[model samples]
Every structure is written in C-alpha cells, then in structure tokens.
Target: GESVGLHLPTLSVQEGDNSIINCAYSNSASDYFIWYKQESGKGPQFIIDIRSNMDKRQGQRVTVLLNKTVKHLSLQIAATQPGDSAVYFCAENESGGGADGLTFGKGTHLIIQP
Candidate 1:
C-alpha cells in the first residue's frame, strides 16, 4: 500500500468544539484502517484504528468509525483544542496487505478557531 494524497480544502473548528473528519475509499476489500494526525513538521502519528470486522473504535479523545458497506471512514474528535490543529489522514490496508500494507488517502486540514 502506497500513500496517494490529495486534500479537500480545510475545516475550521472552535477550540472547545467537536470535529468530525470523513474519508471515502473505493476499495471494498480493505480489511484494516487507521487514522493519522500530522502536525506542521512531524511525521504522521497514529490517532486511532479499526479493523474491518468492527465498525467503531475509540481512543482517549478520538473515535474511528468504519462502514464497509459504502467504504467510508470517519474520525470524531471530542472537545477540540488548539493542539488538534493539523492534517488528518485515513489509511487503508487491503485484505492481504498485512501489517505493512497501508495506503493513505485524502487529507483534511483542521484549523482551530479562537
């Protein structure tokens, strides 16, 4: 799985509000998914992940939902903060891609408003 990237404008949210980022993929055979957050200069960091067998998984302040029926994925951030400002990416691993098989898709730029 290779990373192919494009972006959809930007999302602006208040510092204490909630944020939901969505991603859609065309691969129906994808069996694993991950949500990553990339700050200005750092590498992509793992935020949350969900396997094809499940629909939703949650982390400290984040949640990942996967809908295989429509090949859609989303990340929900509760109580957004200034630290939440970054580019988020959704990566998919095909059925047989294994642990190292992850392909990144469209990234959403999140801007925190005052």
Candidate 2:
C-alpha cells in the first residue's frame, strides 16, 4: 500500500545549530506541501509551504525542499533555538485547491539540546 509520512520519529539539535527534518510522501498527485510546528499542548502552527511545481522554498529561518522523483520532503531550520523545539509535521494537499483537507504526516519531534 501507498504511504505518506515522516521518516524520523525524533531529532535532537544543539541550540544555535541547524536542524533538518525529513518526510516521505507517497501520493505524487499531491500539489501543495506545508510544514507545521506543534508545541506541547498546542495545535499545529504553519511554518512554510511549497507547491509541487517548485523543488524548494525558503522562509525566514526555515527552508522546505521537495523531491518529486523520490517523493521526499525536508524542512531545514537555521539557528535552531530552544523555542524551536517542537513536533514538526508535513502535510500534503492533493485536491488541487479543492475543499478537501490536507493529509498530514505522523510528525517528527524536534528537541533542542542545551
């Protein structure tokens, strides 16, 4: 069966260092990709997003990379801080701007090591 999900369960990074979180998606039909951050006791918050047409996109301190050939996606965080410690998730939308909700990955727990 096809699967769309994150590749790692957790990632530990030192403060001020860069962090990379990986995800794998199965549905090539997915056109939109979004990365979200979820702190403990809080809902997922949007971080960055990229469309399937592009292979990479950058935000303030973050970058989203997509590899359609292998169906992989990655989020890179520059200068990871303690506040950046949270569960990160990758979501995909295949409905092509339709009303259907996105399908989210399991999520990767990002821990900032002091």
Candidate 3:
C-alpha cells in the first residue's frame, strides 16, 4: 500500500504572482517522479516529471528540482495567478511498474500573492 501524510488540502492565491511549495518523499530508490496540480476537487493534472538520473526539469512557466542527496523536491511557478492556485502533489514510481500505484508525497498549500 502507498503511504503519505498530507495534513492540509486547500490553498489560496491572488490574481498574479509567484509560488513555491515543497515536499518530502520516501523510498530514496524511486526512479520516476511527477508533479501534479489539482483544482477544486478535480482530478490531478500533470505538470512536470523528472527521472532519478536528472536533477532538474523545466516546463513552460514551471520548474521542478530534485535533490537525491536529500530526498527533497520543490516546484516553482512563475507569474502565479488565481488560475494557478491549486493543490500540488509529488509522486514517485516506487513500485517499478505494473500493479503497484505511484506513491504520493504530502501535498503543500500554494498561496499566490496579488
């Protein structure tokens, strides 16, 4: 079974700005990593992904950085907006493949400043 401890589920953001959130993951051996954004009880949408082989990856206005040396990760959003306000989650493919689901890290609340 996948195990994660997320205490909060909501975030508040303004009209436009920037946001940064952090997550700590288990299973230092996980190879594949992904970040997702979920809006108001909706399904998670893929934002970016990084393999254990790499330390950083970038998207349109988003960037994800991984530190294998510390088992930590972070998401950086540029020009954050009300639309960008959402729940962000990090997941790892701890199972390698098949049958096992991706293990998720405790999500963070991203509040954008106007």
Candidate 4:
C-alpha cells in the first residue's frame, strides 16, 4: 500500500519483485541529476546519476533513466528486498562549471512488502 499527503509520494512492492520510482524535476538547465535512497533516521545514500547529455545510466541492481524532454527521471530497482525500503529522491544541479549545489525533488517512499 501507499499514501500521499503533505509528505512524499509512496510506492509499495512485494519482496523479490522489481520497483520503479519516478520523479519530475523543475530545472531544465540542470546538467546533472542524481538519485539517492534514505532509510529511516539516516542520511541519503547515492544510488546513481545521469548527466543531461545522457538518457540513461546503470548501477549495481539499479538503473536511472533521464528524459530531458519531459523533465522526468525514474529509478528501477532489480530485486525488491526489505533492505531496499526507503525514501528515494532525485536531485538536480545546474552548477555549470562550478559547484553551485543541488535542488532536490520531494522524494518517493519505497515500501517493500513481506
């Protein structure tokens, strides 16, 4: 099950299944994008990243897809597990040759069902 409120969106999946998390960014000028996963009471951990020049990228058991045209990004997790349960967020940066910092999306909570 999932819930949506003033907080982030949610996606629930059963163990052993695959999970797809989607995000929409507001910055068209952002040249870089990164996906992060955060567990309860912990900092966000980097999952993967893709540049504006690229449409897709892959990591261990994860994939990040970028659609510049629609300003959308999605993360695909190969195998759902309890450990994978967390809130996933996408960040965009327009640093443009310098580190200007990043702006993050609201995030989506990934719930793994037993």
Which number leads on TM-score? 2
- On lDDT, the leading prediction is 2
Candidate 1: misplaced stretches above 4 Å?
1-7, 97-100
User: Global lDDT for candidate 2?
Assistant: 0.91
Candidate 1: TM-score? Answer: 0.89
In order of TM-score, best first, we have: 2, 1, 4, 3
- Tens digits of per-residue lDDT for model 2, 51-106: 98999999999999999999999999999999999999998888655437888889
Residue 89, candidate 3: C-alpha displacement in angstroms: 0.6
Worst 10 residues of 2 by lDDT: 94-103
- For model 2 the local lDDT of residue 19 reads 98
Query: What CA RMSD would you report for each candidate?
Result: 2.5, 1.8, 2.8, 5.3
Q: On residues 19-38, what C-alpha lDDT tens digit does candidate 3 reach at each position? A: 66666666667777889888
Query: For each candidate, what is the lDDT?
Result: 0.85, 0.91, 0.75, 0.82
Candidate 3: residue pairs that collide: 17-80
Instruction: Mark the regions of model 4 whose C-alpha exceeds 4 Å error after superposition.
Output: 1-8, 97-99
Per-model TM-score on C-alpha atoms: 0.89, 0.93, 0.81, 0.88
lDDT of 1 at 87: 94
Clashing pairs in 2: none
lDDT of 4: 0.82
lDDT of 1 by residue, 1-114 (tens): 344343464899999999999888776677888999999989999998899999999999998888888778889999999999999999888775444668888689999999
